[model samples]
Target: METNEPNDGHAGNPFTQVPIEITISVGRARPLVRELLRLKRDAVLPLDRRVDDPVELYVGDKLIARGELTELEGDATGQLAVRLTEVADLRDGL
Candidate 1:
C-alpha cells in the first residue's frame, strides 16, 4: 500500500525572510573593593582585563560570539573575531 502525501503547495517551504534585532553584551570585571569605594570624582579603579581582550556577545542572555574591541574613527566597536558557539537549530531555521 502507498501513502498519499498532502500537498498544499507551501508545506515544504514555509519560511519567509524577516529582519531580526540581535542584542549584544559586553562583560567587564573590576575589583570588588573598588566598586564598594566608588566616588563621584575618583578614578583609581582597575579593570580585570586589558583593552586588547575580547568581549563577549550574547543573544537574549545566551553567549554566542567573542570578539576583540576595535576603534573605528574614534568610536568603540566590537569586532567579531571568533564564533565561540552557535545554536545549530537556529542556523537551520535561518
Candidate 2:
C-alpha cells in the first residue's frame, strides 16, 4: 500500500457551494379566486392539499427534492426529506 497525500490542486469543494432553493405550492387558483371574490371582511380560503403534502425543492429552476413541512425546536422545518427528482448532471463531461 502507498501513502496518500492531500491534493491541493482543486480550487474548492463543489458540494460545499451547491445552491439550494425551497418553495411551497399551495393549490390551484381558479376556485380560490371565485371564493375570494365572494368573501367578506374576514374570510379564509382552504387549500386543495393537506398539511402533510410534499413541498418542492429546486436548484436553479430544476426540481431536486421534496419533503413535508415541519417544525424543528419551535422553528418551522422540513423533515423526512426525499430527493424525488434531479435534473441531468451537468458536470459529468466537464
Candidate 3:
C-alpha cells in the first residue's frame, strides 16, 4: 500500500538525463512551382487538416503519438502548444 516510497536505484540512469525530440505533423501540401512562385508576403498555403483535427507526433521519423493543437494566451511570447490525445504503447516507443 506504500508505493510512494522513493527508489534511488534509477537515480543514475543515463536515459533519465538524455533528451529526445518530438515533432508534430499537422498535414501536408503539394503545390506547383508556378503556384509557389506566385506567392508573395503574407501568403497562405493552406494545409490539409481541419481546425479540430489532431496532429501526429513523431520521434525522428517514427510516429509516437497524436495531439491536438492549442494556443497559449497572455504569455507575451505568442507560443503555441499541443495537448496529447493519444499516445503510443511503451513497447512501440522502445
lDDT (CA) per prediction: 0.54, 0.55, 0.84
- For every model shown, the clashing-pair count is 0, 0, 0
Residue-wise C-alpha lDDT for candidate 2, range 1-94, written one tens digit per residue: 3337465554456874576565545354456566767988776666667766766665566655466655553343544334343344445521
Winner by lDDT: 3
Model 1 residue 68 CA deviation in Å: 1.4
Span of 10 residues, lowest total lDDT, candidate 3: 1-10
lDDT of 3 at 60: 88
Error (Å) of candidate 1 at residue 10 is 13
Q: Would you estimate the TM-scores of all the predictions?
A: 0.43, 0.45, 0.74
- TM-score head-to-head 2 vs 3, winner: 3
Per-residue CA lDDT of model 1 for 1-94, tens digit only, reads: 3338665454446363345555544545556775657645755555566666666666676555566655444343543434344343454443
> Which pairs clash in the backbone of model 2?
none
- Comparing 1 and 3 by lDDT, which wins? 3
lDDT of model 1 at residue 10?
A: 45
Candidate 1: minimum summed lDDT over ten consecutive residues — where?
A: 79-88
